[model samples]
Target: MQNKNHELHVICVNLLATLWDYNRVGKDAEDGDIEEIISMASKSDLADQEKQVQENIHSQITNFCTFMDQILLPESKSHETTSQKHSTAPRPSGLSLAIGRNAPPDTKFEIPETKPLTFAESCQRIKDLMGYTLELKPSQIPHEQAGQGLFVDGEADVGSVIALYPGVIYSPAYYRYIPGYPRVDSQNPYLITRYDGTVINGQPWGTGGETREPWAHSNVYRPNPSEPPSETGSDRVWKMLSKPLEGSRLGFNGEVLERRNPLALGHFANHPAMVMEPNVMVCPYDFPLNEKGMRAYIPNVVFGGVEEVKMKRFGSFWFKSRGESNDGQMTGPVMKSLALVATRLICNEEVYLNYRLSNSKRRPSWYTPVDEDEDRRRWS
Candidate 1:
């Protein structure tokens, strides 16, 4: 139940994050603003909201678990006593019984070398043939304990298609090996080589790969971790477009891109201009401030980091399944939902909210007494 709620909160945040990216329009923002918005919406500010959502989700999940427990209480109690023994009938397998992998051959699948067929094409061919042969979709194997026999309907040629393919199978890891790939770890659900030259469960013979690759994660997609920052095209754009909001003295000078001379990792970590501030890991509601106070200040602090922008953007899409189930499955939608919800309560009423101050019908911001306790500040 706890796990279920955590999953729900993650799904909710993913939904909001997806919405944020999808809603982006107007002219391209200055890099700093883009980074700031991305970071705040996806990572920094939402961290607090995610925490609160997780708590709520957990509470709901606990209630659900409790309800389920109550419903099954009579059956459980009866199982312990001889007077009212529950009938011990065979349990019905949900979906797994239809298609499964049981005692599959020591299968050696060799690739036909003319050209490598993609994993999808191979799977599709198998599906097309299944019309004549007796077999079920791979997903059903989970509910059926019958194992690999699920692929066979009293005797059908399942191995014929699998044998024509290369040892390489598509799983999360194999995606990296594809041309123009990003930060995929080598060890993964797919195997580069078939272990022991045989197939098991109609997938592969080998043990699962060693990589800690999270599916649909942005960190693993753009800005491949193995590549240097200088070589990254996206990083170049991130740097060039980064600047102060478009009307202040700093904004006009393009000084936000100015790097400090002496710092080794550029000026961000060590420069006098880049002050070191504590980063709170929790989400908005979990933090000390109320929603209005948090909304007003968090946007500024969250958008502060240029590098963090991509992570926030990527995280929005990282966790999702495709098609009808795709709704709110990604982080983008999740952040957008939060932003939309907060917008009503915290009015950012400046006419120039989306524009540079010089271009807007608005008064210049004045330096006033800062709400020291309410605002959260951080340095990149």
Candidate 2:
């Protein structure tokens, strides 16, 4: 398994005192009284320590991002600007990609180690090389009540980073703000939590977009409780967050970004079936917002207020199969976000991920435990 996908895994299991504090405060603090607690947690000494780890995470994610940027380029850049010529043709969605044939024998696939690059530099180089982005056709999931699944427009190698989960990032401190609160998932299936307590509400970010735009979301959408339905508890998605907000104004919580990063659709990935193993796994990627230039490709915004909360520690992943979730890797404190990296080479087929639901909770009819032991350990 040379170049095994997620060899770095992107998870750290340190006690993350600040992270746990947020988790505790989010669940316990009375509404409107949490700002001070969160403020204190954000400035903790541990928070400073988390920043150190974040630096390494920044390097690791960019390395993988650039690596994916290189191998996913399947067309010859010299071939008539394939990205523009094929506007109607399928492009990679959930991540940026240019149309290309697989690299020829002489292409320089190896990135030089002597020169380290900022994420902005790596992203810009890839953008200049590949012109257009965002193409894909989803396939209807084969089970009853299942939603459509994300399908890549082109092939990617086994270790490639596939789609990024785009949306409003809600750290543990602000979990109460998520519409539906303790039952957030009841009204929104687009929510995904990191190994740490951070939660990403993809409900605000649809399939991304075709061009760059400034963005933010309420992170406060909940289902319309009174809506009529054909079946009991049949449907929700009411009181929703506004679709990707657009404007030229910049703020502490907003920025213009490309919506077509081919990997922006990680939220669209569905759970694998009982007999099927997941082809991709979730990795928490901490994006450094300080890099102004790279903002265009990152499809996310921090929820208001907690934008400054620095995660000081990480928690364990519930999955035993993900045994690599070790505290020895305790790394930086940045705005933690989620992304899906391929576990094996993925062709233009549907992408599947493990939801790893808690056994104590009521699961949907279609939900099947990927591993029974994992469910117990995760919720234990």
Candidate 3:
């Protein structure tokens, strides 16, 4: 029995390795490679030990192959880049790379290539890449009250990436010129007006000198009644458009800004209604700086230098918690895009997040902060 178990393990490992190699070659697995594995399994004593085990083996192989086909098959529109085709050599492991940390010495990180996709296709691709499917639609909780929101279509384990906060980026100067523009307040959802000068209330304005519809208005703010008011005794409002400028006498120009992309489903995500722990948190998209000719921010796994595991899990795609770096020195380029990350297990649940503009007060009742130590243990 021991020998049979060992043999089965070896066969499985070999099959997985072959699949990995086939992926690198940018080709589908040959029938012979797959048939040989099945043939070997059938001949092995292990298959006789348990009918269930045999069935499991068959199922896994089929699923793996199907996944491969989706990736390897050529798209009608070719999206492969020169760098990706040339860098198709097999890596030592399939583990997902950790962001925020410096690449190991002499390690060259390569961004994965992607094809141009319509908004629908992009949402589907995100679902495929993360193994989690989410839909942004009218909330069952009554649109008259809670508004449209995001719900998980399938199980999303803790640390899974829920979605990217897609939108057109704008500068703070653009918002300044709008007359009687509501001051940044705690009650309002973050707003990014459309490039075409459309407002959230469906009014049009030529403030930004553009004539686009407002994308930020698509995301509705569902107030969480269970959440306690600010402990600081002041209304905490977050401004989505402005941030303190670095090393300039202009005294913190709110230069960084973004409006929700109308095509992105993330715009429909709603705020938490009752203050149970929110499953999602927002962070800046970290890999492949915007200046690198990236047309849009899409969530995909990026491989780093280390090769320790086969198939890095979904959690590896987002920013991990890190202590202040060497003498407070900043690492690599700053990220321009924001991403929505899962902070806890989110299986078929209506996802919620704290939309409070201020990050100062703790909203323990409504939001569950990421436990760095726990996150490390799970991933490590």
Top candidate, metric lDDT: 2
Q: State the lDDT of candidate 1 residue by residue for 1-380, as single tens digits.
A: 22433443454465444333433532354667656655665664456655545454333223322332222224544223221221332222111111113212232222111213332332344334332111222322122321221122222121111011111112221222222344222332221211111111112212112121111111222224565546467644444333221121110000001011000010011101112121101111111111221111111111111111121113212211224433534232111111111111111111001101122223223211122222211100
- TM-scores of the models, in the given order? 0.16, 0.55, 0.38
**Residue by residue across 1-380, what tens digits does model 3's lDDT show?**
22433443444334333332333333355777656645654555533433333333333323322332244325641343423432553422112222213323233434233333333443355457546566666775433656566788766654344555443232222232222333422343434332122123112211111111112221221123345534331222222112221111211111111111221344455666543555665433333332222222222211121111112112212112234544775544332334455656677778776443223444434334334343233223
Candidate with better lDDT, 2 vs 3: 2
Model 1, poorest ten-residue lDDT window?
A: 258-267
| Whole-model lDDT, model 2 | 0.51
Provide the overall lDDT of each model, using Cα atoms, as 2-decimal numbers: 0.23, 0.51, 0.36
Q: Alpha-carbon error at 359 in model 3, in Å?
A: 12
Clashes of each: 42, 28, 11
- CA shift of 160, model 1, Å: 48
Give the top-scoring candidate (TM-score): 2
Question: Candidate 3: worst 10 consecutive residues by lDDT?
Answer: 250-259
How far residue 228's Cα lies from its native spot in candidate 2, in Å, is 21
- Model 3 residue 368 CA deviation (Å) reads 15
Q: Compared to the true structure, candidate 1 yields what TM-score?
A: 0.16
lDDT of 1 at 32: 74
Question: What is candidate 1's local distance difference test score?
Answer: 0.23
Q: Runs in model 3 with CA error above 4 Å?
A: 1-118, 125-129, 170-188, 192-263, 290-294, 298-333, 357-380
